[model samples]
Target chain A: MKLASATLMLSAARVEAERLGVIVCVSVVDAAGYPVAFLRMDGLALGCIDVCIKKARTAALFHMDSADFARVACPGGGAYSLELTNGGLTSFGGGLAVRDRNGVVVGGIGVSGASTEDDIAIGLVGLAALS
Target chain B: MKLASATLMLSAARVEAERLGVIVCVSVVDAAGYPVAFLRMDGLALGCIDVCIKKARTAALFHMDSADFARVACPGGGAYSLELTNGGLTSFGGGLAVRDRNGVVVGGIGVSGASTEDDIAIGLVGLAALS
Candidate 1:
């Protein structure tokens, strides 16, 4: 993804998190799962930082929301143990593939430091900023 | 480091790399060694991405240029085998500690995808942008 797009996603996520009265870390990665932009709000727990990046990579690498990927990677699921690969992956909420104007997946955004539902909500807000 | 400062550094590095006629990956990290911003320019080799991050981390962790750290980490040197202690580290040129106006170390910038000398030069340009 272009740096302009990644910065917009990160800014949108930060605004949504602030509006929700919670601190969070957000990460954006290109289609190849390399970091493009990242922000760790002043009050976010340090441990959640890497989780945010992994979630974005999980979405970018798999071309789906991390939560959706989780369903397929769960025990007895078709892609069980898939997280073990790709350095590491976070198969959970808060990650969403970002698509371009043509609906082509170009990157991903991830949010952490809130409940799964909130993280997902914040990430969706970021994704919306792109379109 | 604040996101604004990190963004400035990344932008400066990009401009320098463009002027030098090279594609590069640049990374900025906070004092604690967490990534702040990163950009892998179009055409940058994928292999250099992580190296860029590691270089930033090495500078942030040691509060010195990675090239300077390399001198100490070399075989039979004081910091021999130190790179293995951190998740990993790049003890070579291309990474430099970033300081605030007060001369207080705040973060670091790292560049990759060019000769070590060019990488260091680009990173230095990034550091200059902050001042």
Candidate 2:
């Protein structure tokens, strides 16, 4: 996604986060798992910053929601231990891939700070802004 | 620095990179060595993503340009082998500290995906934008 669009999405996510009473770190990455834009809200935990970026990268690189990837990476699953292989993949609820109108994967969004469900919800809100 | 200001710096760096006809990855980190923003231009090498972040983190954590850190970390120097101590420090050009008017370091910036000299020049341009 273009940087301007990515920044718009991030702004949308930030609004959602404020409504939810949470301070979080958000990241957007292109299809190749490279960052397009990132934001760490004031007062957020420093650790969440990197985690947010990695989550976005994991979604973009895998072309799937991190929650779904978590299921596949669970013990006894075909992709067990996959998270350990790529720098550090985040197979959690907060990461989501962004798709174009034609369903082509364009980028990804990752949100961190709140509960898993809230993170996922915020990420979805961010992706929705892209549409 | 705030994410907004960091994004401005990244934008300035992108303009410089475009003028040089080189694609690059840029990263900004807060005083605690946590990412505030990042961007990788389209078609740039994917490998530079993590490297750019690390470089920024290194600069922020050490409060010095990566090139100067290189001199200190070189073999026979007082801080030899220091690069391997952190997660992985990049002791080279392209990483620089960002200080506020009070002379306090607010953050750091790192640029990658070009020759060392070009990367350093681009990072400097980015820093200059903050002023």
Candidate 3:
């Protein structure tokens, strides 16, 4: 369960975004829901900050990726949103869970800019590379 | 940019876990940082819910995806966690942003019960399928 360092995570994300043709903001946190790294691309909306954090928390806490929970949530799926106690929680695009070589629940990734799928795509590619 | 639905996301995560032979939890959020779907595999810690939520938040907000950001930030990388006002944000693993057919951030995905990387992978695969 070894986690990648914040430095590598940010740099890789930047590189990946460049390849993907998207300017993205990324955030990383530890297993305890603490921040480890944060990077934002220029010319992005300030609102992205909030979106990124909640995405990270969902990955960290659930031990699951946020994207999975998001599809079946809300009233149609029984509204798990209210079930969660985390007020700062989010179910948006551009987040992913990070793991170490040891397969431990290490950190997370959050992205902004472009579309949600693009955010996820860039994020997955970066994580895959790091892994 | 189409995000996977909860049914497919969960089923795939479940199938992947079966192949991996591990128990896990998963979650998903929407573009607006809200819940879209959620699932808890048996034999998981209750606290994982919080971690997953925060992780998802990081991805959703930053738009860089979760894993990438988890690698950076904190006392070492300049506390981007506190920089954002979102309270439920996490920098952990197991979450990702989901998109629509048009590349809009329609929702998110999350997973648990295993390594964050595995979680990310499962989420990515599911999202990829939907895309």
Going through the candidates in order, the fraction of native interface contacts each one reproduces equals 0.00, 0.03, 0.16
What DockQ do you compute for every candidate structure?
0.02, 0.03, 0.08
Residue runs of model 2 more than 4 Å from their true location after superposition: B1-131
Sorted by DockQ (best first), the order is 3, 2, 1
Give the per-prediction TM-score of chain B: 0.96, 0.96, 0.81
Residue A119's lDDT in candidate 3: 81
Sort by TM-score, top down from the best: 2, 1, 3
Give one digit per residue, the lDDT tens place, for model 3 in A32-123.
Answer: 65777788888878898777766776677655577775753332332233224455556666778777777666767777777899888777
TM-score for chain A, candidates 1 onward in order:
0.96, 0.96, 0.85
Best model per TM-score: 2
- Candidate achieving higher TM-score, 1 or 2: 2
- Residue B59 of model 1 has an lDDT of 93
lDDT for each residue of candidate 2 in A20-100, tens digit (9 for 90 to 100):
999898999999889999998876645466667877887898889987877765445577668655676765668899989
As for model 1, its CA RMSD to the true structure in angstroms is 14.2
Answer with 2 or 3, whichever has the higher TM-score.
2
lDDT, residue B107, model 2: 83
Q: Which pairs of residues collide in model 1?
A: none
